[model samples]
Target chain A: MIIIAILIGCIVGALIGINAPVIPYTYSTFLAIAVVAALDSVFGGITSVLKKNFDLTIFISGFFCNSILSIALTYLGQKLNLDIYLAALVVFVGRMFTNLTIIRRYYIEKWTSKIEKDDKELQQ
Target chain B: MKIKIKKEKLVMSITIGIACFALMLVMFMQFNMVKQTDITGIETMRESELRLELSSWNEKYNELNTIYQETVGKSEEYKNERESYEKTYELLSKELEQLNKALGKTDVEGEGIVIQLTDKAGTQLSEDVKVKRITEEDLLIIVNQLFAAGAEAISINGHRVISTTSIFSIGEEFLKVNGERIVEPYVINAIGNPDYLKSTVSGKGGHVDALKELGHETSVDINKNIKIEKYEKELHTKYID
Candidate 1:
């Protein structure tokens, strides 16, 4: 049921985005960093749900806070000529990979255990 | 306990759904923005570097053209062995010079008039009426009028008016003459009888008067000596004899 809701939301969002007016070139960098942060939060949310530790308040706060922090870091990087966004990108993407591994293992173990149980029942 | 669990599950699904929607929307918008911009895959160079490269290329071209002209002139002089050949060479050279002058390949100087056209000040014009800036057609008409009044050579903004020259609007803000972009405060110089040229362009109901009526600043000055430079573009002909 949740999967179906997410799918519908994505389709509607894409349609609205396609028809929306574009933002200026100057702010595109900030938007890009924010997107990476948001993507990390989504993956983390999925992992927490699989582990039965999902909290709505924590998820929402993480989503907004991560994006804002990344944008601020990008601005500071520009002012300092340091390219600090590279550091943020590495951290976020690394965490995303870890969360992805956890989600993958959970689904794989569930499917394998179900198959094993069916085989034992057949023998009995 | 069962009903409460069901309500919690519903709330969780709704929250996730909203987050996913926002994420997809931003992603799609970013994608669209990237596609719309034309700078993809092209590295931008510093402005100074680009300018230096252009100037060097132009200098090289000018040096080569001068050398080529010198060599051609020497060959014509040395190859004329017979009286008949020498006479033919003399006639051909004269014809070439006249053709070059007519084609705007040679610089010209004489008495003429200079006409200046500029946009009206924004503060001077009434808010209801739009101020008129000079257009390509207006410049073309003025050039035609000068030629009709016996002007021999003409130039607009230092771009010599030649047989192949084209003046057209590039956009609302700029006009292109002989494929080079030019901006406002256009100065047109013509070489001919100064009195005749001024009378033709600045007379009653002429182009200058028309421009003034549309709220443009216009002026004409007669000069004893005006020089029009040779057209800088190389003329290419494929089908003509």
Candidate 2:
């Protein structure tokens, strides 16, 4: 049921976004940074869920807050003639890598242990 | 117990679905925007490249401005020169017309007199048979008298008299003025003061009265407007320097 809901939401979102009007080139920087922030939050949410410490409130808040904060930073950076979005990108991408490592380890450990248990059961 | 667990799982799924929905929406929107934007457009140019492009355009604009100013100045100069040229042409043309008038090369008009001399010796009664018919010398004397009275222009029998004019006879048969044959009655036109011209050619000692006593019919008329034609023959000196 959860997978079906997620699939439906993604498909609907994709359809709506495809039909949406294209934004100006100047604002594309903000959108790009916001996407990175949202992707980072998603990775973090999945990592916490695997760790058995998932909070729906934290996930939702992180998703929206990160996107907004990054966009604001990009605007401020333009005013200051600074590349503040670069800092945001680096931070988000680093966290995403960490989350990915955690997800990868968890899956590998579960698979290896399952194979060992099957071998022991067959011998018994 | 089963209902509570189902409710909790449903809520979690719904929140996750909402989060994913938001993410996909923004991601796809950015994708479309970036896809439509031309990567090679000025918007995407680096700062240094934009600066360079702007500077070159400014240089080109300044060059064109200089050229435009120079072209305008040149046109103004040409306009002034053309105006002066037209003025000189007009002055020269007026002077040439005046010179032609003075040279007797153009027709003249003024208040003057007309004289007609009819040689009636052939039909005259009791006239001396030896009184020769009107001669070139008689006509020449009358012309000389009209000139002395300030006649500005003169013509005889349609022949204009210029500085080079000659009055003579080809024989006793015909008279020649400006080398063209003329017969009686000789009609002479002289442009001048009308009363002055008539009085000079007539009266007691005048050539007309002298010719009248010899049986030639002579009459002088004062005219308000008399036109003397221009000299047609070209005047060129062969020996005079």
Candidate 3:
């Protein structure tokens, strides 16, 4: 059921995205910020799940709040003639990388331990 | 315990799906934007591309020029329509004013004369001679004479004399003009040429002289300004279709 739901949601979202109006390039900066923030939140959610400390409320709230705050900052930056969105982009991307590394290291260690146990049983 | 775990997993999956959906949507939108608009510096363009850009801009300018001219024409048409509407408004207002004047619907003033008629004093007459008090018939006769003398407007005892006016005796003690009881002194204001009005009312062989002969108090004053009030009642016509 869960896999089917995700597949449906993704397909529907893709369809809607294809039909969606193309935003002007000037305001595309805000979209970029939002996309980066959401991606960072997703990676963070996975890392928390691996560490057994996941909270759905915290994950969703972080996702939305980060996006909104980043957009606001981008607007202020434009008024000040500065590229402040770039700074936000860097932070979100950096956090995403750290989360990815944590997830990768966790799965790799789990797999290696499982393989060693299986080899000992085989020898016995 | 297994059911609870399944429910938790279902919740988590839905949340994850929503997040995935959002990511896909945003990414696709960005993809579309990137595909549609080429973000390149103007100085890096080739000569041929620059000429094509210039031609497209000129075409856009021509389209915009036609639109601007069409808007200007529409504005001029609206201005003319407003002017004509204003002219019609002015004409209707003037017509309303004139109709009101002719219908005795408004107070009027001009060079005219005031005729005041009072009952004969008891002391001035002998005991054998009976005083003929001023009656409504005498008023009607005098009003007719004033209108005959080209009086534009007239009033008796402050009651406007319109086309529907009535002058008659109610009882032995009171006379009615325009349905209101008028007493001893009747003030008649007539708006017209003062000399003509005076000559018609108080002139020799006029109704005023006849009243004086009947021992009634009569006086006519030529005035430069005499105001006659409008009729108090609303004029209605049910018979006219």
Candidates, DockQ = 0.42, 0.67, 0.36
- Candidate 2, lDDT over the whole model: 0.88
- State residue B14's C-alpha deviation in candidate 1, in Å: 3.9
Clashing pairs in 2: none
lDDT ranking of the models? 2, 1, 3
Fnat per model, in the order shown: 0.51, 0.75, 0.55
Q: Model 3 - which docking category?
A: acceptable
Q: Can you write out model 2's per-residue Cα lDDT over B1-241, one digit (the tens) per residue?
A: 9999999889989988887888898899988987787666675786557879999999999999999999999999999999999999999998998877767889888888999999875764555464568888998899999999998889998788778899999867999998888888899999888877788778767899888888678888888888878888888999998
The top-ranked prediction according to DockQ is: 2
In model 3, which regions exceed 4 Å deviation? A1-124, B1-51, B121-128
Q: Which pairs of residues collide in model 3?
A: none
Cα lDDT tens digits, model 3, A1-124, are: 7678679778877887887899776677788889899889989988998999989889988988898999999999888878788899999999999999999999999999999999999999
Clashing pairs in 1: none
Interface RMSD of 2: 0.9
Question: Over 4 Å off in model 1, which ranges?
Answer: A1-5, B1-11, B43-241
**Model 1, range B11-106, lDDT digits (tens) per residue?**
877877787788888888888887776573322543346568788989998999999999988877676556678798899999999899888999
**Which whole-number lDDT from 0 to 100 does residue B202 have in model 1?**
84
Best by lDDT: 2
Candidate 3, B74-139: lDDT as tens digits:
999999999999999999988998888777999988889999888874535776877777778888
